[model samples]
Target: MPLALYLLALAVFAMGTSEFMLAGLVPDIASDLDVSVGTAGALTSAYAIGMIVGAPLVAAFARNWPTRTSLLSFILAFAAAHAVGALTPDFPVLFATRVVAALANAGFLAVTLTTAATLVSPDRKGRALAVLLSGTTTATVAGVPGGAVFGTLFGWRATFWTVAALCLPAALGVLKGISAGLVQEHAADGPASHTELATDGPALRTELAQLARPRLILVMLLGALVNAATFAGFTFLAPVVTDAAGLGELWVPVALVLFGVGAFTGVTVAGRLSDRHPGPVIAVAGPLLLIGWPALALLAAEPVALLTLVFVQGALSFALGSTLITRVLYEAAGAPTMAGSYATTALNMGAAVGPLLAATTLGTAAGTLGPLWSSGLLIAAALLIALPLRTTISTGRGIEVPR
Candidate 1:
């Protein structure tokens, strides 16, 4: 891949951390802001809702603007929102900032994914996506846990400030690294059909229309199911390790790190092979996760089994998740510049839905392990969704995937 891709990934790490970093800081925020903990927790939901709704809207709005112009604008907005969030006193003001930050994150991330596709040759799109997603996985390991620690040492505001600070360089790097021709949709080599609509400044309806493809819908649905499996289990991982497994507080981060490390491995491996072998990757990981989550539900009390399964499931979940996101990009090949927004929507839809399902399961008989059972059911659903694809893509080599 290119240096631009790495720069984008760096920016993504910061944004991804904020998506869940607030989970650790909720109590402090509730105390400082003089609100109940439940109210403070709504900020994360605000971010998730913004991500789901803003992606397509922002993509369509910026569809007419120069790519570099839009990208830089979103990056600056993200940084400024965080800065404002850090400095804000009123809870409502901070809530607004979170929404703005998420909108900015959505826009910039959508553009970056399509930008990555435009930067690489067709055979390497999977690798490019892997590189991008690895940033998110890394955030799960380092950025989030580290942010929690940082907030504990300093204050939650300091973590917000740090994210804001990181965005400045990322914006500058993206400004320098992006091709001028790319921003103008005049690539030197060939048609830019995949990057933009056939006409200049296409209407929002036109961009939205691209999402109507049957195959694209199925691919995106599959993506959502995969993510639902991940987030449903992960949103409660700390509690699962501590409350259910009877591990100490120290083991929470260890479990998260194990999962995050496995995710790194999964994304790395998927990037190298997904373009040519997505079918096999999905086929293997899907079944393993179906078995793994239930086994986790049954064996959480066993420290050795619990830790080992967390690592293994993390790897398998991300491996399949990476492949599915890549598939969404390819399946939406006709989406012009809107393909990345489609990917974002599918990705965050799971982020929103998974937790809702898991939260409901919490008060039931399953308690902490309810999320694991939910995750297992999601995996089964995902496998069922892919069942039809098996016949169509019997050999992994046949799909016309990303570059």
Candidate 2:
């Protein structure tokens, strides 16, 4: 609800656009760089791998830095990486830039989430996080499609330049907004200026120990499995829509837009509900996916049914994702940034794994329908892993369990 929170969202929008726009540019990049489509596609994997490996490392290294300082540094690095990417003449340079961009993106997201949580009251943390994450959903709705259109009209390099141009304003906004917010807080609190910020040494060690607990590990696993469930079906949505659902190639964009709308709606709903009843929201969302996927597989040939199911499935999947993120933040209270970094790491791992699983399934006799079923099973497993959180909350031990 603060201006700085919205500014953070703007920064996220810039990063998310760069991250997702690669999907649309793969063909152009492959042709331009004289490589196979699959090789150019490896750029996406490089970014994910960078996020998975870079998040924890960046979090640890920035442990002693002020929140605003870390955020500004990361955003600037991300902008510079995009600038390099826009001018690169070969695939190797482009791939290296992707890795650097992802590293900066990971650090920016982790710090931003932690900073957003500190800006609000404990009771409103979930809603604040949802507001921050809405940038990614918004990117899916507008940025990716806009980039694709731009790339189609101009060239792929032009799209990268556009992304680089967007990042400059976001970085400047973050610099101005966070500085003002911190200065205002300092004026209000006097000598207790660092109260809302993370400390180093002993505190860091304790938070690391807390992060390693079995219950928290389960929570991280749940986050990963839930993501796997969503991406397993989503990564191959084009084929599923055309081959399995018997829809035309033209319908794929329509289905994607519907899914994006649903995702935006879901995040909005989760923002309101998660602050009050995260457990129940996640409980319902997982089951919705569990039920929706099988029905999707069965009714793929029905155009009307497939359209409706895709929207609902997207809504449920994102709703569950936002709730899981909030839960991880709650469970890892002392080290919010590191917790967020770990959550991002888990989600990236799942993003990588889900596509592989879906691709393998496509190669089997089950074909496209296999991904839908596989997603359902993964969600079911995630639900089972989530059971302990419900039990902890019901027993009024949620606060104690994390410590």
Candidate 3:
């Protein structure tokens, strides 16, 4: 691994911490802003919306920029947004900062995906993605709980400052990466610069047309459904631990840490298997999530049961989620320039939509338990939707190279 890879991972850790930490901070933000919890929860969706919009737009333009320059620009923009977020007292201003931070994060993530893949041999693409995404998984383990703890000790604003400060070190690392001569310009026409196995070009029309393929659309929807299930349940977990399970505020970070630990483990295992055994991994985890999500809903009131199920569900969620994302890359083998953005958009769209649906369940008879039930339904829908997309995943090695 290059020093640049580790630097890129740091970039992900900084942004991902902010993204997942909102789950724990929503209650704090709501209380501080004098808004309903559901209303404050919209911050997560705002971030997701930014990511969804940023993916395609930035991808379209940044596709031709130097790899180092693009990464540096996005990282600096992200830091600036988080700085604004940390200082803002107004809810709307804070909300706007989250969206801006997400847009910068989205552009960085999309470009990183393609950039990381090119660092490895063709057969190791899955592992490259996994390595890049590991930053996200690691952020879940450390940064999410750390953010929650910071929010508890100081304020939600303190956590934003912490994330912004992280970017300083990451920015320095990116400069060092440039000095190492590791990441050069990404020239679509100069050489075989893109990830696709087939011939690639700089044609914008060729890239846009791939977004319309019926098969690609199905895969994107499948990714969206899985994320919908994840965020729907995950966005409300602080409440589930405290309000539903009758735990103290202290337990919130503990609960998040357990889920984070599980996610870290899940993504690590999925990374190794996704390259050669994606079909089997997906086949097994999908059914398990179906059963596990509902079980979490039924046992939401039992502290031990809820905690145990949170770990299990986190593991299942990311393991399956990572595989599906890798599948998107495979299915998008023809859309070299657009593939990363497409994958980013698919997952972010689900992230944007899920919490909105979960917000509807907050005050119902289901109470705090509604989020998990919604998640369960989303998983069922995801499985049904994957039927068509799964046909393309091979049972053998190379995860069935796209024809």
TM-scores, one per candidate: 0.93, 0.92, 0.87
Better of 1 and 2 by TM-score: 1
RMSD of each: 3.0, 3.3, 4.2
The weakest ten consecutive residues by lDDT in model 2 span 394-403
Model 1 TM-score, 2 decimals: 0.93
Each model's lDDT comes to: 0.85, 0.78, 0.80
Better of 2 and 3 by lDDT: 3
Against the true structure, candidate 2 reaches a TM-score of: 0.92
What ordering of candidates by lDDT runs from best to worst? Answer: 1, 3, 2
Q: Candidate 1: lDDT of 285?
A: 88
Per-residue CA lDDT of model 1 for 1-403, tens digit only, reads 6687898898999899888799889999899899999999999999999999998889878876667788889989999999999998889999999999999999988888887776676656788899999889999999989999999999999999999888888888778987544542323334433344334544567657767876778778888998999999999998889988999999999999899999999999988888778888888988999999999989999989999999999999999988888877877666657889999999999999998999899999999999999999998998887797764432353233222
Query: For model 2, what is the alpha-carbon lDDT of residue 258?
Result: 79
Q: Is candidate 1 or candidate 2 better by lDDT?
A: 1
> What's the CA error at residue 379 for candidate 1, in Å?
0.9
Off by over 4 Å in 3: 24-42, 88-93, 178-200, 394-403
Candidate 3, poorest ten consecutive residues by summed lDDT: 189-198
